[model samples]
Target: MTGMSRCPAHTERAQTSLPALGIALVLLTVVTGLGVSMADAAIAGAERTPDERRVAAAIADRLVSADGPLAARSNVLNRSRVDDFDQSALERSAPPATEYAVSVEVADTEIASSGAVHSGTQITRLVVVEARESRTLTPDLTTTDTVTLPRRSAQATVTIDPPAGTTIWTVRANDRVVLHNRSGLDGSYEVPLIPYETTELRFQRAGSIQPGNVTVSYDAPRSTKESLVVTVDA
Candidate 1:
């Protein structure tokens, strides 16, 4: 009878232990599922960084391209347009897929920007800014028969100060007749330079004024290096 009682007690203990084992297995499964989910999230977050970086780089490239909104030529920005840039223009120029921000700097001066910048992938691109430059040209006719422009010019202000008796007749640029006055010429004349080639201005039939003075003013397209930063947030 004592042995029979012990067997029944053992069975009861086994049944109680089975529930505990089942509970422990359920807890283990829950913990494992949580760990897998956390790992997947981490991996997804890591992959997003490269995507943001690529997007930022592509946007920057487009901004500095020849056909880009801010560019006058390939990788060259128009200084006047850049100065006029605002957030609205920037957004219109660069439409981001996700949240993003952009800032442009020329010669260490922050020129334009868009959106709010925070922690994000950034891309830096080299850009050139075309700034208008002015210079004065003085012709030394006494030294030489022809005066050659140092650089390509689009316009000039010609002032003829001839001697008492002599009068200017014609002006030729690179053998092409730009100005022709059969009677006589004096005073200031605005001349347009040839677009295709370099201009060599030659004065014909000037009086005692051995050295004639001509002022050629033009827009000189100058370029400088700048940094364009584009940042994208995911």
Candidate 2:
């Protein structure tokens, strides 16, 4: 028996379908390429999250350190320097990677920023800021009978030893009377120091009493502590 011959019209239809098959293959390749690109972007974004967090933590730690550029003491920031901080300071303090943006906030208030911050990682730190004036008074009372304070102190604590058969009459700071008592006194007393150019403290006594073991103490202005937040975008 003779083998069945192929139909001429059917062969032409099969040949024409080859171009459609090729077009379908091209479309599949393009779709696959696009999907791969999207996947890579998502993976990169996920990887950057941890890296940005680490960078932000490191930067915040450095800023709050005693030896860092913006710190006066450990976890204490200089208010003037913090106010002056800007993009240039951020760049100088940050790592040498230019792919990230950084911003700083103290007590929920934005202080410094660099680059656009749409989305990224964040870190918060406890920091102290000395925005007010601070001073310490430790007079040279060891060598002298009287103590003088260099600055005008608002408050002072005086410690003294009363001599036998003597009564403490009055206390004077910078020649201005501050405390006066008729009874015999011994131990510590808190007194408000008068604001003067030179504040001097002396005890007035009766019955030939000599001052012994006297100390005057003054505390500096108080500092405030708050949260410091750092954000980084990659």
Candidate 3:
């Protein structure tokens, strides 16, 4: 060749050492893995910041709506009668049920450094919330309630003092009802229950108080002569 071209063998070796398709595949795998990892992290981080607060606010607003299902539940405000309190309904009605209580804390978190272009310029403020899951069922039942109302009051008055910033309040009755105060989301209201039976109550919220319902799902009385039966399956 005119310029003393390199040997064909040398050229082949260099090409084999760094094949174009191989390099491209390696880069694609790295980029894809990074993308998936970032998406996962974003979802996980959403539970603790502005995203969490936004979700909480939306839930609170929805709970206040009359059309929202949070107001009606077997153990909650299902003011009407049903064979069994619908656990499925409660679950479907309010997603991300933060158990016994949901506590919201607003704060600011500093962003130490910005490594690349198009990044935010200042420290970001964050909303932190701690949801206190209901522990009533895990190890024991700890709810204490006492009822004293007229036999036929068209409206029953119950004052509930839930944690502050509560969006939804769910109530379950032992009996009947005449009217329910469609109150705001402040955790206090007068509710009318049916005549002559004890009621079990649970309060929950996604964004606002779940609608109330009347039900005959009072707990059954236990007889003194009843014995417990235990069976073990092999």
Candidate 4:
């Protein structure tokens, strides 16, 4: 009787208390882990700023290297003129997620003989550079001549029945006068010049707003009303 003296209710209470204590300890461990994680993240953020800047500078340096000694004068890089090599390097070192504006110019060079100070002022080559997350693909352009004029008049409709949304079509006669430019989106361009010499009708793909290829064909003026065919593929 003495050995089994514990009350049944007391045993039940003891068992419940143990489980409660265990649950409390588990919650405390989880909270401690979360606090430690947050502290580590804060420290990492503090450390990353300078490192990112340094990497950005290095990217700029590499970009300048391509132009040789003239690159030393350059302080910026434009994203538009980026060649394949520059593009690859930029992707590796500084990802597009980071925004950057780089201004590049060739430094001044001594004229050597007269010692004329050619200050590396920003020249026509001034490039506006920007880093972005997305890129617009260049459309594939193919040119085929429908007719080569022995003598082309500077003024004349070089395009026959042209595809829809065609522009920048140029026809030069005698190699000087600007005959026609359908550069605008819609409407007809009037050319007052008479056809002289072998006229060269050039239908160039002015480019498309979306990603696609544009095919433009030059049709003889005598062919049909709707003669020109310019195809655009994105």
Candidate 5:
């Protein structure tokens, strides 16, 4: 027998190894991409400090409180106070703001800030801004003994300048006696009224009362909802 050509088993083994090597390379590439992504997220998280967020939240909370400098009531900001808000006002209202770079804004307008803040943690609150305006009303008491106020007021200045023969002794507001005199009632008097109810001023007198005899001046608060934002950078 002349030299017979034999099939080599090593050649078959080499062909099988090629497929396994390709699969291993694909798995390595996938693992490397996941590692890179995790590392980037970790780096970004490390850059943000917890103090900034805490301070921002605290400032926003204090600003909307009832006792705050800019608030007339809880979550209601006074228009005059908001206009006067500044760095000193912020520090006075929120002491934590003094230590950090804090910025306060309302309706996208910067109202107060302790420091220049480009970017940082932020806290937002929905609030109402109130503006009070003084208005006077002198209703005709001849047609009816009751006079209803158009707007709600916390307090009012009641002026009783009755003409001769009109002996006014008592004044009732919303069925509640606000002013009473045994002999006679005259001059301007400050009366406290509830802001939630519509007030009807009633006069108890023996004679006819003319218009402009009783003048009531009260503050009418107008409110509009707005957004307040506080940013802190450490």
Candidate 6:
């Protein structure tokens, strides 16, 4: 060794005192923990702006209301409408959506968002989503010319397959003329009806008809409960 180099043990001891190193590391850990705790406390104490919370609540209320675009009844959302809901739909349904950053979700799936949201207020409401499912019914028209539907539907698919001698001239839904063919109605047709009341289809025919001659297919609404969440950032 040209310059009296220190041994490994001596070099290690000279680099730093064991007691001092231990104390420094312990103090560093304590300071870091304190800093983290203080940051958590500050964040917990910070609440969203009152206006943000109010707007969030309002948007949530409007989305679940009966007259809302996404809803079919009070707190009952239409699945078709919900699927079509977007930022434009949100702004149209709730005017406040245009002024603030708003996002709406159901069952954790985001349906509509107006703007970017980092952090703000959230309002949650319980709601039911109604989906229109196809259901078919073939009424027993062997003896009676009238048939009542079991469920209410907005429109029905009326399929006519009459025998050679039979001819259906007209069809009515509770006195409302749905189909009229002076020559003879011989094919399938879609008929619109009022969904608010029970429907009874009456057929006007000139020849004999039996069961399995007429069939009806309609969409019945099925509902499932879900949570509607609205978040607003201002």
Cα lDDT computed for each candidate against the true fold? 0.73, 0.75, 0.35, 0.38, 0.87, 0.87
* Model 1: how far residue 123 lies from native, Å: 2.7
TM-score, per-candidate, Cα-based:
0.67, 0.49, 0.21, 0.28, 0.79, 0.66
Query: Which has the greatest TM-score?
Result: 5
Model 6 steric clash pairs = none
Candidate 3 structure quality by residue, lDDT tens digits, 154-217: 3444444334454433444543332233453343355555534444344333332212321121
Better of 2 and 5 by lDDT: 5
Instruction: Locate the minimum summed-lDDT window of 10 residues in model 4.
Output: 225-234
Candidate 4 lDDT tens digits, 1-234: 765777776899998899899999999999999999999988876575455445434544544445522221243332333322332343444342134332222222211111122221121233333222322212233434233432223333222333456454554433544545455423334434443446443434454323232222222222111111111110
Which regions of candidate 4 deviate over 4 angstroms? 1-11, 57-81, 87-234
Regions of candidate 1 where Cα sits further than 4 Å from its true position = 1-47, 97-99, 194-198, 210-213
Per-prediction RMSD in angstroms?
Answer: 6.5, 11.4, 22.6, 20.9, 5.2, 8.4
Off by over 4 Å in 3: 1-10, 20-49, 52-234
lDDT for model 5 = 0.87
Residue 198 of model 1 has an lDDT of 71
What's the lDDT for candidate 4? 0.38
What ranking of all candidate models by TM-score puts the best one first? 5, 1, 6, 2, 4, 3
Q: Candidate 5, residue 48: CA error in Å?
A: 2.3
Model 3: per-residue Cα lDDT at residue 37: 100
Supply candidate 6's per-residue lDDT for 154. Answer: 89
Q: Cα miss at 207, model 1 (Å)?
A: 2.5
Assess candidate 4 and give its TM-score to the true structure: 0.28
